[model samples]
Target chain A: MKKMLAGYDAVAEAVKACDPDVIPAYPITPQTDIVERISEMIADGELTSEYVRVDSEFNAASTAIGASAAGARIFTATCSQGLKLMSEPIFSASGMRLPLVLGIANRSLSAPLSIWGDHTDTFAERDGGMIQFYAEDVQEAMDNIALAYRVAEDKDILLPALSCLDGFILTHVQEKVDTFTQREMKEFLPERDPVHTLDPSNPTTMGAYARPEHWTETRYEVQRAVKRSKDKIGEAVEEFADVFGREYGLEHNGLLETYRTEDADVIIVALGSVCGTIRYVIDEYREKGEKVGLVKPRVYRPFPAEELNKVLGDAEAIAVMEKDVSLGYQGGLAIDLKSALYSNGSRIPVLNYIVGLAGRDVTKDVIKKVVEETKEMRGKDPSDIGLEEEERWEPLREELLPGDKDD
Target chain B: MKQIRIHGRGGQGSVTMASMLAKAAFETGKESQGFPSFGVERLGAPIEAFVRIDNKKITDRSQVYNPDIVIVQDSSLLKLVDVEKGLKEGGMIIVNSSEGPGDLDLETDAEIVTVNATDIAMKHLGRPIMNTALCGAFAKATGLVDRESMARVIKETFEGEIGEKNVKAMSEAYEVC
Candidate 1:
């Protein structure tokens, strides 16, 4: 039945259908609804799962690790600070080669303690050895949950996976979502026959300490497994498209989704929910007879280098918009895009435009401006064009009060 | 295609209102999408939710700029956010306040429809959360979704006692607004 489902509820329902044996979560804004729904589903007997309400995000991840290692399909969700707290176990989940799936609501890292939409929290774990797939909207968020499980459980690529969505941007959005029935989900996602499990029947040693003599090779083998996971991700997305009438290309569709960029001279590259805005802006510009397009990267972890280089081969200028800052460096997505193009020996001028952080709105007009700026920078010197500027930032509040307005 | 933006706070149910409106539109056999933009992660911080309804499926997923209708769940958001920034000329502005349409202290070229949804909600539901009541007012003003479809969705969403009170609140809001 067609139901109006909020993004978070859709995810929770998909998780329930997947029938994960263990669920460990810590409550965080934007992501709280997902965990709360899951917990309630378990409590109401709608879902029969080991609902582990952990004291902290770290414990949440640890619990998932232990459960997965003990041969159960495990699930967890976190955002911003919660993700940071779970960083150590995230790496452990990867290192131990546990086939775990995590629903990550991407939020800004704290200091100022902003619980808004941003890539800082996810980008911080870039080196955590987990494969990451970003969903553009609520539908993808639900689809990716199922796909992540399938890809992670592939024996040849037994590694953890993360399905990341813009914290409140996509998570809290209510949209028409088609939930899969158990029969449909079973057909879409292969049942788990874990490569390694804490089977008391088998009596195997797990996560045993490797001495320095053999530790280096063990680390190398883990690296090899991660590299192999890229291929598995592509295959899984392809299989999902075939089964569900949706194609998330691995080598081609998996890496990037280019919209109206074939004949366009200016292309804007972005990820996550902002890609949706860029697509809207591109349509508007196209209506005005401007050759503007958008290239959205779907896979952020393995860094879709080959696909991006090919898609951007003909573009005159590429504008990269990132929600997370790289501090002294270019924005995270910008840096990755630059590296991808650099390896191809392409001298295409790539401009970095950072917009929409802390839940700031990225409207179509802002995207149009970025395209206009990229066109204006066509003949200008790279040194003359400054990527970092205050004007690029979207204004959060129209009126700033000097005193308290609460009275 | 028509887009609508709802402005409120974190716990104020702007997202819920957006979803209900979309559901109402869907029940009428139209394609609709609703989403929210938020960050404060706290109770009272300002938040915004958007809805797009069309005869055809909406492929564009962007914030509703040049909205055909604007629904303000809180009047205070007017001073904080540019609520009328991209309002279409002659579009409708439905605010949940005690003030009349022209009573609002703002400049707008659109048709304004104001309802004291807070009073209606409190009178019926005994709470100040005006999302569902404002949604009823929005439906009455814009006619984007029929009141009957909205009531059905509301009944299905809320349970037992709360559902009865919210239905009363919505009916009162529709009558006055």
Candidate 2:
């Protein structure tokens, strides 16, 4: 359907089209609408699913675990505090190898009580054993809902997947989204296959406690599958392209979306809706004869180390702009990117800019300045205090971020 | 791209107005996007919402620091915030007020157009949800969106008498503008 749908409603509609067997919903800010819309669908008899509203996110996630173990295809959504409240169960869902999908509207965690958009929620879950796909906008969120199922429920990759999107920024924003019919959704993503589910006749032991002797191997198994899930992600994206006629870095390890980076001397790496702003700045600079480009890493987990090397190796310098931080350290994404580059033998000088935390707006002007700063820091050791003070640029951009007085 | 910002109190349908404008633009086969500020504050707080429409797809997700058009669903918002921040030169300002251009107390090179949207909405919609009515004036003052598309979206949004009444209020203000 050609329609204007908010990312919030779009995810809900996509979930409806997929027709999951069970949805255990618990409402939270920014993500509450997805649940509300799904509840409305169930109420209208438009969808026939066991829609259960639990008391909290923890309960919702726990219910998903119970449902999935009972051979039901489960789905749920949460953000920020809700995600933290249910973190343990999230890891458990993946460990149990349940082919479930969790829709995440990424939001800021709070000591200050903010209900705004940020990646702090999902970034905190980087090691939750669940495969993660970060969507850029309304269209991506809707499409990835269906894609998440295809990747999650693959026979070789019976792992839980989270389709993460920036809260409020993308969730509440309305844009023209092309929605698919149930027939099309079925063609793209079929009903979940219960490969190793709880069966009454053929009873199997599941979620049993592992002693010290076997705990290592059990975790290694999940870690190994987490790494191997990339191939499954690539295959799902390839099949999706073949059927839906839209491509999303399927050839590039289904990892990074390299935009105008082919001939650029400088590039900024970013994620989510902020990439939308970064692309605009890159275009503006390009019009003025600046060789600026952007590489948006869509898959944060299974961090695209090799792809980053190949795509960003030729750049003069690179900046990793992120909305989530590690507090005493640099941003989570920037640190991961630096590690990715180092491991891949790419000697590029990487700069980290922490931006848009707690729903702060990263405007075109902000991104443009970041590109300029990265260009100036080219070929220099960012760790050298003398070089940093000479140009007066903080590698972490402490001055440019929000919630601080001076900048 | 034509950028439009709507300034109003929280419950005055500021974000809804922005969404309808973008949706109407989409219905007319233009690429459009709409968003409210990240602050989901209390009901009476002054807030800003934005809509961007273009011949080609828009990629910028930044807030509209400058807009070609400004629609004031509640004229009181003009005093609370910088309603004219970054308006392009010779921009258009549409206000929901009984006062004429000389009495609006707004300083800008924008062509000032005022419609008593509250009066129109109260008459036709039986309440002061002046967003739809302002869209009507927005159509007449700027012609960014046609009145028919605005009515179609409004009707599609609301159901039964409410939808008919919203369309009626919007259409009446369109002729009045």
DockQ of each: 0.49, 0.84
lDDT tens digits, residue span A1-407, model 2 = 77999889899988988888899999899999999999999999999989997998899888888888887888899999999988988788778887778999998898889898888889889988888788888888888888888888877777888899999888989998888787777788877777777888989978778899988887888888888878877887787787777778976867768889989989998888888878878888899988999998888887777888888888888888888778767788878887888677767788777788878778877787788888886776546423343221223455556865564
TM-score attained by chain A of model 2: 0.93
**Residue A370, candidate 1: alpha-carbon lDDT:** 79
Model 2 misplaced stretches (Cα beyond 4 Å)? A381-407
Query: What pairs collide in candidate 2?
Result: none
lDDT of 2: 0.84
Tens digits of per-residue lDDT for model 1, A303-346: 77878888888888889887877787768888888777867887
lDDT of 1 by residue, B1-177 (tens): 898988888889887888889999988778888876554446888888889998876656556678888888889988998988889887888888898878897798888899999999899888897777887887788788898898888898898888878888888898887
lDDT of each: 0.82, 0.84
Question: In candidate 2 chain B, where is summed lDDT lowest over 10 consecutive residues?
Answer: B36-45
- Which stretches of model 1 miss by more than 4 angstroms? A250-253, A377-407, B7-15, B35-50, B56-66, B72-86, B95-108, B114-133, B161-165, B168-177
